[model samples]
Target chain A: MTHILLRHRDIPDINTLNVYKKNGGFAAFKKAVTKMKPAEVTEVVKNSGLRGRGGAGFPTGMKWAFIDKNNWPHYVVANADESEPGTFKDREIMEGNPFQFLEGVAIASYAIGANAAYVYLRGEFWELAAFLDEKIAEMEEAGYLGEDLFGTDYSLKIYTHLGAGAYICGEETALLESLEGKRGQPRVRPPFPPSYGLYGKPTIVNNVETLTNVPLILANGADWYKSMGTVDSAGVKIFSLSGRVRKPGNYELPFGTTFRQLIYEYGMGIQEGRPVKAIMPAGASSSLIAVDDKVLDTPMDYAAVRTLGADLGSASVIVLDDTVSMDWVVNKTIHFFKHESCGKCTTCREGNYWMRNLTERIHSGKGTGADVDLLLNVAKQMQGKCLCALGEFSTMAVVTGIERFPQDFKQAVRSNS
Target chain B: MSLEKKYPKEVKQLLAKYPPEHKRSAVMPLLYLAQREEGYITREAMQDIARILEITETEVASIVGFYTLYHDKKEGKYRMQVCTDLPCALRGADEFLDNLCANLGIKVGETTEDGLVTLESVMCLAACDRAPMFQTQGPRRHQVSRVHDRGPHHGIGRGVEEE
Candidate 1:
């Protein structure tokens, strides 16, 4: 039960240099620079099976490997824009254990042979960004960062970039656009960040939680790191539990920890002891899973959530009780995606607007069965056609709500009539 | 200072995006710069921006008027934007707004008569869980300077409270 990915949760004040160093922090960077090669570091991460915690569970090592070596002066951009509803794990890590996060960024940059790295944070994280800047300066003073780190030729300088309060910037490409001082919108894929990113240079973008695991991966070795969680999804994850929970906060557990243990044991069950109706396992963007015993017992991980028809995105588990309405939940989520839509792509821009109108009508009791069907069709059409996951993700709640909680919509429609 | 001289570098760089004959492509960045300097785009500033961009005053005005982020009128020293979207609203943003209005001694869409603060409701600010949050945009350390400058211009605006 030792913490792997989220070791800082157990260690006190890991944000401080002394506390962090005491807990075997930056030893990874020292070892990686002095002993291991860049490719070897990436191979360790790849072998450990660490995936991106930023909704898209992409392999971290594969993302680094994808960087076009032909493109010189490659960049590393950490997606710290944790704007997904019910997601606050990154915020906690950045605020509570900043040094570890910074060291992770440094290690990732070193592993990918990136001389410069940027942590693109949400605008609300202005304070966190400033704090991180101070931490980066501290790292520089400690000789863990900057040119000739630990007497090697590997030079890395980490910078913190702020997004202008756009959720779309959480998308890797969109993050690059914002970092380049443009509007926060997603660029077309196929030439992903690894090929062409900030300023059209090869870039590797990793999530905050994903990079935070790097220090441990190097400190403990691949097998030791992989031993904590399920086979496919190794290491501990910080599940940000919120909404109607008596003891709502972040709970660090190994991946594949059951939803029941998280909700009841960690979250202390519902606030008023109300029956748990549904669980949005991955924030507003996740499909609403009916909180039956089966789902409660289902382990919390990428593959486990897949069996329940959802992804363990960011592991932002929002527990909903019977008092909350599914229609209302869908309406809230729709409103968010609609407002945050950068309007760069035709489908997400127009489709989200259309879906919002339908969700509002349905939730307000003004919608009919045909309206519901049309909403579903619009969401379906919007899938696979978006320039980024924001567009594709906007559909999860809508599709799942209608499919799993039809009675709620029917009741809302009936009430309106 | 004139808008052209204030942002000559930015204007020139942005203008290079278009052909010399099509200097109008720099209109957006010009307006953005103007607003950044003056806090809000006035009619005269818009006219100057249009002149620099080689576009009509009406074109500049229309573009400035379109985006809600761009203010056509003079904003108060502090601009408070509260998110009124569903997530925030459900989380008692309305009550928080009422409390804010009462505390600030002004209603929504109205600036304090002394111009200390302009209050407006935004559609969303992207932070749902941190609901009932409002952003105060102005010089973070110039509250005294702003109050003293506007104290003689007008008295405080009317305070409306909903019971």
Candidate 2:
């Protein structure tokens, strides 16, 4: 089937404004602005059953609806900080089908009554930021953006903002803080971004993939999108296939695609034809899934993956074959989280630091079984204490690795004892 | 020199992106502008940015301190950040980094004798599929490169020779 969100996969030069225009690009934004009310546009999304692709799986329309109507000017900040280890789908979307994504941003701005929007890209994407800035300028010149878009009083402008380098900034609140030129640490939740964000104004922060779905959902009817994916998780998703696979790249498949199909059919199986040992459905933040016949055949959806004790987060499948060890995997994830802890809440800052020390000692063969147990205990202690998901996510691989792959830890610690 | 005095037009354009009352939001971009010429943010530039944004220098310095991209001290002309995170490591990024370090005769986070490139291992660059990829951050430029079998030394040598 032709790609839906990843339209560039099917069409040539879809990144170009002219080519994108010819292929029914801005028609959705034009239709929404000319024919429908903002609430009506949002209603269509509400019925479509679209969820945020940014791991949390929150309902997209519900997030848009939560914007404080009493507040003077709602804002839309696109979370383009695609910093997750195995996730590279958003980068492809922004580079390949930029107009479609920008059009989605436009439609979302119209839906939430946000005249101004910001795309917060990670600092390493400086070139991508320039590329997107050019795209935003192109939209402005075409009169699709700027004051009085589509000859309607509804004006819209989209700007690209760059985060210096902080994984925690992917959190919406922390993203807002970074956009505001503050340290990229997450904020306390009670007042989420929808109620209080970006200079204390009500804002809608949607992931690039989530907002990219907006224009398509608007162009095609809600039922068209709902028909693609499973009931619980509707529509197609770009699975970022990476690590130990023959063909590791972005595979835009429907939500229900199995791991077996992704790794074998799309990704062409593991490297060297080695047997698959485990899978990290998410990136470093994933629980290490001990691969079995049931898991290999299980449908890859949020709810279904939850049955296997993991969220199909951003759907970045990192295949680990038999050659790899779980101890090393846990160590790598710990170091990542420790480096990116943001040091805001004591739990995440200290927890990751301590976990890193334990994982290092355990992985380097300098620790006994006591250290392995201590590492598991430290990780468990950090589970419910973090101010943000980063802290909670830090312990996932560690806890899962110890519990599921006890033999790996036993072997790792055996050498030292 | 102050950022406003050096590039008045660029400074104005950066501040224009944010509202006048909330122009403090322009600090990150301004920090980038200040670091454009030197590849590392200087004290004077931070002060200049702090003055322009109406925030304290500490506020600006705190930002430089917090984010990894904004370095406060001088280093090589170019910073080559390699991703050795989990996915990349799974695909031989760790070995790639080790080989690059061996080729350079300097460990990670050290500048070459020529002072052209400073190698550093970083977190994921979101290009997991492209294992052994590295991004170069120099004055006014940041470029990500996929360093396959030929080794990154040739690329680094070419980059140095170009300078």
Candidate 3:
């Protein structure tokens, strides 16, 4: 099938403004602003059943509809902080097919009545941000942005915001805080970004991939999008295939595509033809799924992956082969969480610090079986107590690794014993 | 030179990106500008940015300390951050980092005698597909710096891709 999100693969110059304009770019933003009512745009999206691609899988249109109409000067922030482990699809989309993603940002701004939008890119994407800044300038020069866009009262100005190396900033509330020049930490719930965000105004924070889907949804209509993917997942998703594969890259596949097909067909199987050991479907946050034939054949949709006791979060599938031990895998992940824990929340901050030592001991063959059990216990203790998902997610690999891959832990403990 | 005096145009553009009332939003970018030439954020840059944004110096420092990219201490001209996160490690990123350190005649976090390069083991950079992948965060350059991810014997890919 031809790629929708990754049209750059088919057309080389789609990144340029002239070629992008020729290939039906910004039409959706224009149509929504000049012709359609904002509610109508929301209605179309609601009917299409498009969900946020940033792990939560929340309905996109419903999120737009939730914007407080009483809230003045509504804001739209694009979550381009693609810091999640094993996820590189957004980076490719921004670099290869930027116009579409920017247009999606534009359309989203119009639908939510936001006059100003910001693309919160990661700091490491220095060149990419400069590229988008140029594109924004191009749109402004072409009269797509600025005062009186399309000769209508509706005007829009899009800006790019760079995030420093903090993974918590990827969270919507934390992203808003980061944009406000504060320490990137998650805020208390009950008033999400749509109600109180980016300086206490109603703001809609959508993932770059989620916003990238907007222009097409507006141009092609709801049915065209809903026609693709499974009933639950209503559009194509970019599966970031990586690890121990011959051809590791982003595969823009429909949600119903099988993990087996992604790793075997698209990724060309494990490196050196080694047998597949496990799969981290959601990067480090995933509960390690034992890669059996049955699991491989399962569809890669959100609901399908959920049945396997793991999420399809961001669809960043990190394939693991037999050469890697599960104990060492958890150790690496625990270390990452420890390094990244923002220290804002006790559960995450202390939990990760505590787990890191146990994992280090076990992996280094300096701990008893009791250490593995203690690590799992510490992870469970922090599960529901974390202020945000990062802490809770820190334990998924630990709990699941100990329960599922007892042999690996047993070997680590026995070596030291 | 301070950020304002050195790059006035860049400073204005950064300030213009956020609202006049909410100029504090530009702190991250301003910090980036401060680090652009110096390779590390200077004390004067922090104070200047804090003043420009109507924020406190400590506020700017907190942001600098929170994020990894904004360094307070001066370091090498090139900071080659390797992705030794789980996925990258699975594809021999750890071994790649080790070999690069050996080749450079330095440890993982140490700088070379010439202060040309400093290799670091960082968390996942979302480039998991490209194992042993890294991003250089010092001077700007057009060429792609190559650091091969294959085991010790593959030979170093090439010099730092970005200047």
Candidate 4:
């Protein structure tokens, strides 16, 4: 299939505004602003079953519909803060096919009646941020952005905001806090972003990938997108294939593509053709799925992966071969979570601290079988208690690793003598 | 000299990006500018940023403390950050980091006698596809910043981020 989101793969130089406009770049956004009503633009997106690509598969259109209309001065913030370990698809999209993503951002702002939008990029992308700034300037010059866009009374301006290294800032609320020039930490729920966000205004915080889909959904009708993937999961997704794969990068496959296809056909099989041992489908946040024929053949969709006791959060498929030890893998991931735990809540901050110690001990042959159980217990304790998904997610691999790959722990714990 | 004086145009543009009332939003980028001269963030830079943004120096210092990129203390000429996160480690990033440190005759957190490189482990830089990869916090930012931690970005101005 031709690339929808990643047009750079299909069309070279789409990052340039001239090349993009020549290839129908901002046509949908222009159409929405010029011809369609703000609510009508939202209606078209609502009809399309585009879900949030930022881990949570919440329907994108429904999120836009939830925007509090009673509130004045709406805003839209693009989640370009792509910091999930093993997840790097968004970076390629922003770096290569930037205009499409920006076009999507512009469309969302028009739909939400937001005059201003911000792309919250991770600080490491300081260079990429500079590149995007130039692209934004080009769009503004081309009249796709800036005030009175497309001859409409409405005005839209986009800005790039760089976030200091905080994994927690990927969370919508935390992104909001970071944008407001404060420490990045997740706030409590109920007052979601659609209601209270970004200095307590009605804001629609969509992932860069999610917003990128808006232009396509508007250009090619909703059914065109919904017809591609499974009924429950519509549209194509960029599955970030990494680790032990012969070809490690992104595969823009429709949602129903099986794990077998992603690993073998797209990824070109495991590195050096070793037998696959386990898979972490959701980066560091996924439960270690002990791969078997059933799991391998399972379609890589939200519902299919969930049935196997793992959510396809962001589709960052980390393949593992028999040569790799699950215990060591857990230790690496635990270290990442430990360093990234926002410390806002005690459970995640302390629980990850405890798990990291246990994992280090177990990985180093200094722990006992009881210690493995205790690690699982610690992970369980941290679950359902974190202020955000990062805390609860830090436990997924630890708990699943111990449960599914028990032998790795037992061998590591056994006395060599 | 104050950071604003050294990079007047850059500081002015960054401050202009945000609202005049919301000048504090420029603090992070200004810190990036302030760190340009010294390898680490100096106390004076924080005060300069505070004065420019009208926020307290304590506020600017707290932000530096919160983010990993803005260093408080001085370090080697090059702060070579290797990502040994899950995916990177799966592709031999840990061994790569250890070997680089061993060759440099220093530990992960230690600097070489020449102060050319200081090895450190970062969570992730979102470049998992390129395993055994590390970002060099070059003194000149990106100019000298490469995988080996040399170039204009090798040992110069300040920068900032998480993976």
Candidate 5:
């Protein structure tokens, strides 16, 4: 009910320096720099049970702890390349509550002993990046970020880097490759960013929303941070509600909050009071969740979404009513994935292209039941074999559309054929 | 256009990270430099950059084509790209685009004959709420020094005074 990770919702104009400071914005950074040791700060974050909000849900503290401290001049990269379809929560935080996100970046940098933190934003976010640059300069002027922050040895500089509008860059390692001024493509993991990243140095990469939550976790203490969400997935999560909802916007609720509460209560119910037919709980990347009473009442979190055979990735809930044909939805998502595919891997690049053609044919009312079966087969073939999540996640809608809403696909096929 | 003078010593130093044999590794920075110099990448200038990188012109062309930031042709002084994606489209984007076009006296893909502004339709620019937005690139510069400091202007930078 109450916002934890996204306190800016309650506090107006948090983007402004004065308002942010008044709400004790930079307190976490100050504490981390002045009083607490970097390791201690990392320990607090580790104990808070904060996970990466960038789809994977990897523990934030564990990610920070993964940084090879022996590698000097460590780096912290904030993944602001939120290109996932139906995701807009990060944009809100970066544009409206930038300073809070910056403060979180600062704290994370300190915890990881990083001198420089780069916010790798999507190229479309150039204006936001410029705004963030101005904010960073403001923080630097205020001594909140710069040489000897808070008059301590802990120094941090925040830089904003823009991606050239590649969906693959949203993948952490691919983001690093792009930040290092390369073609945005995913690198092999296991050397996973911590050991080798950004010109081959230890790097800790976290999503924009994930970093935005750090300030709250540090300022409120680990136990306080843990008190908000379900026992496992603690703290509040921002759900970017879109499609068919009256109040389609970002809703911040505790991790375990149910989909019913998010869509009905916060979203002001479906637009025109239409009957909810389906839901994409986490943008185009998530498997479709049938919006029945069981799913509506299901707790909205990383773990709970799994029970419904989906992920709470970036909490980009795309609601669909009976009016929207499932075939059309899958086709749209397939088109996006196909166009945005980086072509670094075979499965995603080729699979998405093939699926897109089939989906287009299906949505055009030309595809038959055999075509639907072929699309499903292609999507299944793409699973577990993508170079990055973009390829892997692209199959979600296609697979789920045929599996859960067979009637919609069947009707679409018959109508078209 | 040569980057010798425009990038200055600091940028040159930064560019030095790539080996002489593989100067193509600096394509991203070079693209940024070109953007800074000419506001946006042109077809000829991009080909020239490919020449400098020692890579095939097609490779460079594909890179520029893939990314929305690099414009293939000349853009107007003010390019307002209104995103017509689902989110913005849902929030009266059509009306917003209509208003913008009406005010600018231009269509979605046309630039003002005076080269003052260009209206374009682009995929999600990542700003959903503040949707129906567009960005403008300033005019292209006329002069830039060559890499060897030999004052021969190439590409779009030819025949203008060096800054």
Candidate 6:
């Protein structure tokens, strides 16, 4: 099947403006700006049932409609900070099918009545940002961006902002703070970005992949998109397949594609034909899913994966084979979260630090069985206390690893007896 | 020597990205500009940026301290950050990093004797498929080097030569 999000795979040179235009790029944005009312655009998207691809799985159209109508000079900030551990799909989309993603940004801006938009890319993506800056300029020159877009009073200007390395900034509130030139730490939630964001104004913060789905939804009606993926997940998703796989790369498959198909078929089975032991369905943030035949055969979707006690977050399926152990895996994830905790909330900052120490001790075979129990207790304590999801995500691997793979931890820790 | 006198055009363009009232938002890109010359943000550059954005010097310094990319000390002309996170480590990124450090005769977070490259182990860079991959932050640009196909030695040699 031809790619919807990763369109560049099907058509080469799609990164070039002329080539993209030839293949029907920006037509959706043009149609939305010239003909449809902003409310109508939101209504279509609402019917389509597209969810944010940035792990949270929040409804996209509802988010756009939440923009405070009373507020003036609304803004749209694209969360291009694709810093998740096994996730590389957004980078590919931005680098390959950039025009499509940018057009999605344009359509989103029109729907939310945002006049200015910002694409917050992680600092590591410097080259990609420069590439996208050129794309934005091309859109401006072609009259798809800048003042009076498509000969309508609804004008839009999109800018690209670079974030210095901070994983916590991927959180929408923290992203807004970083975009405002403050330290990238998440804000207290009662007032989310829609009500108060980016300089205390109503802003719609959409993920790069989520925004990329907009133009296509606007061009082809809602039902066309709803028809593709499962009932719960109503569109194709780019599964970032990695770890212990022969073909570890981005696979843009429709939702409800079974894990067996993604891992064995597209991913070409585990590396060296090893039997699959586990799966980190959402990178390091996932609760490690113990892979039995039933788990492997399960359909990959937001709700379906939940039945297996995991979210198919961002669909970054990191396959783990028998060669790997859950103890070592938990250590790696704890280290990542510890380094990226942002020190905003005491719970996350201190919890990750302690978890890192415990995991290090456990993995290095320096800890007793009591240390394993203590680690699990600490992780469970930190589950719901964080100001943002980062802290909660930090505990997923720890709690799940200890509960599901007791033998791994039992072997990892030295016996006190 | 200062950012304003060194690159007036770049500074002006950075400030123009945000609104006049919120020019403080230009602090990040401005800090990047300031770091362009010395490979790290200097004391004077921070002051200059603080003045440019009308933010306090502590505000500017706090940003550099908080984010990993912005450095205060001048260690090397090129910062070679290797991702040894879980996904990359699965593909021998840890072994690759250890080998590269051995080849350079410097440990991770240590700069070469010639002050040319500083080696650092970073978290996942989102390029998990391309394991043993790294990004080089030079005085001018950040370039991601994928050495999955080629060995680490070859990729490191190619990276140092190109930069």
Q: Please, what is the whole-model Cα lDDT of each candidate in the order they appear?
A: 0.76, 0.89, 0.87, 0.86, 0.77, 0.89
DockQ of each: 0.12, 0.73, 0.64, 0.59, 0.17, 0.75
TM-score of each: 0.82, 0.98, 0.97, 0.95, 0.85, 0.98
Query: Residue by residue across A261-369, what tens digits does model 3's lDDT show?
Result: 9999999988899989899998888889988999999998899999999999999899888877888999999998898888998889889998999999999999998
RMSD of candidate 2 to the truth, in angstroms, is: 1.4
Worst 10-residue lDDT window for candidate 1 chain A reads: A1-10
- lDDT by residue for model 1 over A192-270, one digit each (tens)? 8889987788888988888888888888888887878898788788888766677767778888899999989987888
What is the C-alpha local distance difference test score of candidate 4?
0.86
Could you arrange the candidates by DockQ from highest to lowest?
6, 2, 3, 4, 5, 1
lDDT of 5 by residue, A1-417 (tens): 456556667788878999999988788888888899889998999999988998889999998888997878788889999888678788888877888899889999998898888888887666677788799989988889778677777788787776676787888888877765457778977798899987788998899899998898888899998878898798888888877788877878888888888889988998789889888887777788888899899888787889898888888888888887788778767877888888889999899889988998988888898999999999999899988788888898889889999999889888545
Each prediction's RMSD to truth: 6.6, 1.4, 2.0, 3.4, 7.6, 1.4
Query: Candidate 3 chain B TM?
Result: 0.86
The true-versus-predicted C-alpha distance at residue A252 of model 2, in Å, is 0.5
Q: Which residue pairs collide, candidate 5? A: A365-A416, B81-B134
Candidate scoring better on lDDT of 1 and 5: 5
Q: Give per-residue CA lDDT, model 2, range B1-163, as digits (tens).
A: 7789899998998888887889999999988888888888888998888888889999999999999988888888877788899888887788888888888788999999988889899999988778757776666454333333324554665754554
lDDT by residue (B49-142, candidate 4, tens digit) is 8998888989888889888878888888777788888888887776777676666677888887767667788878887888756777767654
Model 2, which residues run further than 4 Å from truth? B140-155
Runs of candidate 1 with Cα error greater than 4 angstroms are: A1-9, A415-417, B1-76, B79-114, B117-138, B141-163
- Candidate 3 chain A — worst ten consecutive residues by lDDT sum? A121-130
Off by over 4 Å in 4: B141-163
Candidate 6's residue-wise lDDT over B1-163, tens digit each? 7788889899899889999999999999998887776778889988999998889999999999999998989898787888888888888888888788888889999988878889899988888888757877666544333323425574564566575
Which segments of model 5 are wrong by more than 4 Å? Answer: A1-5, A415-417, B1-33, B36-39, B43-63, B75-121, B129-163
lDDT of 6 by residue, A1-417 (tens): 988989888899999999999988888888888889999999999999999999999999999889899977789999999999999989999989999999998888889898899999998888888889989998889999888776778888899999999999999999999999999999998698888999999999989999888888888999999999999999999999989999999999899999999999998898788999999999999999999999999999899999999988888888889989999999999999999999989999999889999999989889889999999999999988989988999999999999999999998875651
lDDT for model 6 = 0.89
